[model samples]
Target: MTDFDQFEDEDDTPKSKTQIKREMEALQEIGKKLLQLSKSQQKKVPMSDTLRDALNEADRIKQHEATRRHLQYIGKVMRSEDHQAIEQRLALFDTTSAAYNKLFHQLELKRDALIGENSKEELANYLDEHPEVEDIQTLRNLIRQSQKEVSQQGKTTNRKKLFRFLRETEEKRLGLAE
Candidate 1:
C-alpha cells in the first residue's frame, strides 16, 4: 500500500488537498461578503457630530498607536543584547541630547535678545509692551537705583580728586616761595 493509504483507511474521514483549498476559498468569499454587508450598513447609518468627532479622535489615536509601535521597535533595538547595537543606541541618545541642548541654548539666546539689556529705558519699554513682565519691574527698579547710587559716588570721587589736586598745587607753590 502507498504511504497515503497507510495513513488513512476507507473507514477514516479523509479530506483531499483540493477539497480543503476549495473550502478555504469559499469561506474567504463568504467573509468578504459579510464585510461588504457590514460596510453597507455602516454607510446607511447617520453619523452624528459627536460620532464624527469620536472617529476623528480614533484616527488620531491610531496615528499615535503607529508612533508607539515605532517607539517599541526602537526600544527593541536598544534592548538588543548585541554590544554594537547597544553602543549605537547610546551614541544616538547622546547625540540627540546634545542637539536638543544646542537648540535650547540658541532659543535662550534669541529670547534674551528680545528682552534686550538691563537698561532702564529698555526695561520700561519692554514692560510697557509686555505687561506679563510686571514682576521684573521690581528688579529693574533696583538696578536703576543702584546705577544712580554708583553715578553719584563717581561724581563725588571725581570732585574729591580735583580738590586734592588743587590743594596739593597750592601747597607746592607755598613751599617754593618759603
Candidate 2:
C-alpha cells in the first residue's frame, strides 16, 4: 500500500514524525505563496481571522527569523482549517492570469490583422463579433494614421493607441466587467 493509504486504513496507527513534519512544511509553503499574492488577490482568498492576521503580521515583518516563525503559526492555523477550499480559490487567480495572457495575444493578432492588406475583411469580422463597438470610423482613422506614421517616421504612436483600444474592447468581450 502507498504511504498515504496506510494513514487511511481503519487500523489505529500513529503517523510518524516525518509525515507530520512534511505536512507542516507543505502548509507553510502555501502560507508563503498567499503572502506573495497581490493585495487584491489576497483579499479573495478565504481564510480565518487568525490566519489572516498572521499573514498581515508576516507582511509587516522584515526580519528573517521572525517572519519564518509567523509563517509557521499560519501553517498551524491552516492545519485546523479546510485548506482544500483555500487551494481551489487560489487556483482561480492562476486561471485569471492565464486568461489575461491569452486575451492580450488575441488582441495583438487583431491589431496585426487590422493593419494588413485584408484589413476590410478583418474589420468586418471584428464588427460582426463586437457590434457594440461604435467607433468603427475612429478605428479606421487610427489604422490609417498608424500606417502613415510607420511608413513615414517609422513610429508606432497610433498603432499603440489602436492596440490599446482593441485590448479594452476585448476585455468586455471576455466578460471582465470594466
Candidate 3:
C-alpha cells in the first residue's frame, strides 16, 4: 500500500534464523568428523593453513570445555573452506563410499588380469602404462606366484599380496601414500 511495503515485497527473502543455525550445526558436525580422522588422513584433505592449524589445536585440547570451544572454532574455520572438496576427499577414506568401492574394484580387476592366462602380455602392458612402477621385478614375481597358485588350484596367498601391492602403487600414484 506504501513505498516501504512495495520495497519489502520486491526484496528476496533472507534465510531465517533457524535456517542459519541448522546450517552452522551441520558445519560443526563436519568439523567433528574431521577431528575424528587420523593425522595422516587429515593431511589428505585439502584445507587452508588456518583451518589446518585450528584442527591441530583442536587435537591438543583435552579439557572438556576447551575442546568444545575449539570444535566450535573449527566449525567457524570450516565455514570458509570448500565443503564439497573436503567431503569428497574424506569419502575416499570411507570403504562404503562409491568412489572407494570403484577404485577397489578396478584394482581387483587389474590384479586379476595380471594373474590371468594372458598375464605375460597384461603385465607388459601394465608396466608400459605405469612406467612409474618402482619395483618391476617384485611385481613380476608376485604375478608369477599368483599364476602358479591359480594353475595348481592352491590357496591364493600370493594373489592377495599382489592385490595389496597394486593398491599401494595406486595410493602412491594418487599421492595418498606417505
Candidate 4:
C-alpha cells in the first residue's frame, strides 16, 4: 500500500519525532528557496526588449500550462460518475467567468483612461472613426450623449462582435445551451 493509504488506515497514532522533524526541515528549505526566488525576480527588472519578450513568453507558457491542466481536469470530470466532478466543474467555470470579468473590467478602465486623457473633440472624432468602441453599450451611450453636446463629431458608430464565444461557453457551462 502507498504511504498515504497506510496513514489513512491507521488510528490516532502520532507521527514519529524524526519524521516530523524531517518534514519540518523540508518545508523550511522550500520556504527559503521560495523567498530567494521572489527576491531575485524582484531585483531582476528587464532592461531590454529581448528580456521583456522572454518574460512575456515565459508568462504565456505558464498560462498555457495552467489552461491545459484545467482542461485535463474538466475532461477527467466529464469521464467520471462522481458528484464531486460536477462540483469541481462548476467551481472551475466560476473561476473562469471571474477571470474574464476581471479582464473586461481592466480593459474598460484602460479605455476610460484613454478617453479621459483626450480632449472632447479628439475623443468624439476617435469614437466616430472607431465605431466598434460603441459596442460596449454603457460606454457607447456615454460617448453618444457626450458627442451630442460637443457637436464636432465625424461619423456614425456601429457595434462589432466581441466576447461572443465566451458568452456561448458560459451559457453551455450553466446548462442553458442555445
Candidate 5:
C-alpha cells in the first residue's frame, strides 16, 4: 500500500509516536504523585480495580525494584482512566498549603506581639476585632503568665496556649471551625 493509503482515515492528523510516549510518561508522573498522598487521599482519585490494586501494592512495597515496576504498570492503567480529575484533587492540596502557611506566619507575629511589653494595647486591638471572645481577663492572665515565664527563663507553656487560642479563635471567626 502507498504511505498515504497506510494512514487511518479516522483522524485529520495522527499524533507522532514520540508525542504519545510523552503523554504516557506524564500520566506516570501523576501516578507517582498519587503514591505520595495519604491512603484516604489516594481513595479520592478515580481508579479502576487494577489501578487501585497497583497503588495499594506500591504503597506496601519497601523494595525499590518492585515499586519501580509496579509504578510503570500504574501508568498503563491510568491511561484508560480520567487522569485529569485525579490531578485536580492534587492541585487543591497544593493551594491549601500555601494559604495555610501565610496564615501561620501572621498568627506567629501576633503571638510574639502579645508576649511583648506593649501587649495590653495590642490585645485590646485583637479584642476589638473579635468581640465574640468573652472572658477577656482570662487572656490577660495568660499573657501575664507568659511574660513572667519569659523573664524567669522558664517554660513558655502559657505562651503556647495563647498562640493556640488565637489560632482557634481565628478559625472560628473565619468559619473554618465550629
Candidate 6:
C-alpha cells in the first residue's frame, strides 16, 4: 500500500497543526478568564492548588511581558484540570444565573431583617450564627443608620453599607472572602 493509503487506514487521525494551535489558544483564553476573576470569585472556582498558585503568582507580576509569560504558564497548568467544571462554577457568578440571584436576594433579606422592627433579636441571632463578625459595634451602628434612613426617607447610603457588611460577613463565614 502507498504511504497515504496506510495512513488513511489508521483508526486515529492526527489533528492538523492549525487545529492544535486553536485548541491551545482556547485553553490560554480560559486561563486568561481565570486570571480576570477576583480573588473572592476565584475562591469559588474549582482548580488544582498548583493552578491556583500559578494564578496568584501572576497577580504579583507587574510587567507586561512577565504577565504574558505567566498567563502561558497558567494555560499549561489548566490543560490537566477539568476546564469544564471551572467554567461551570464561573457561570454561577453571572448575574442572570438563578443561583447568583438567589444568593443576592438572601443577603438583601438578611440585611433587611437586621434593620427590621425586631432588629435587636435579629441582630442577636445573626451574631450567634456567624461568630466571624469581628466588629459587632459597627454592624449595630450600620443597622441603626439604615433604620434611621428608612424612617426619615433619607438616601439609601447606610442601607447599602449594611448590605455590604452582611455580604462580607457571609463571604467570610463561607470561606469565600478575599
Best model number under lDDT: 3
Encode model 1's per-residue lDDT on 26-129: one tens digit a residue: 43332222222333332322333443333233334437666445333333222222334323322322435564355445434433333345555654654575
Query: Per-residue lDDT tens digits of candidate 2, residues 73-159?
Result: 888888766788777656645656565566667888889888888888998898998997978899999888877876697888899
* Model 4 ranges with Cα > 4 A deviation: 1-96, 118-178
In model 5, state the lDDT of residue 137.
Answer: 84
User: Which of the two candidates, 1 or 5, achieves a greater TM-score against the reference?
Assistant: 5
Per-model TM-score, in order, reads 0.20, 0.50, 0.80, 0.21, 0.48, 0.60
Model 1 per-residue lDDT at 142: 44
What TM-score number comes out for model 4? 0.21
Candidate 2 lDDT for residue 168? 68
> Would you give me the overall lDDT of model 6?
0.82
Worst 10 residues of 1 by lDDT: 74-83
lDDT of 3 by residue, 52-109 (tens): 9998888788899998888788877777799888887777788889999999999999
User: Residue 113 error for model 6, in Å?
Assistant: 1.1
State, as a TM-score between 0 and 1, how close model 6 is to the true structure.
Answer: 0.60
Give the least accurate 10-residue stretch of model 3, judged by summed lDDT: 1-10
Please write out the lDDT profile of model 6 over residues 54-149, one tens digit for every residue: 988988999999988888788778777898888766655677878668878999989989889999999999989988789999999999999999
lDDT of 1 at 28: 38
Could you tell which candidate, 3 or 4, scores higher by lDDT?
3
Model 1 lDDT on a 0 to 1 scale? 0.39
Task: List candidate 2 segments past 4 Å from native.
Answer: 1-34, 37-57, 69-104, 130-137, 150-153, 171-178
Clashes of each: 0, 0, 0, 0, 0, 0
- Return the top candidate by TM-score: 3
Looking at model 6, which ten-residue stretch has the lowest summed lDDT? 1-10
Q: After superposition, how far is residue 84 of candidate 5 from its true place, in Å?
A: 17
lDDT of 6 at 92: 55
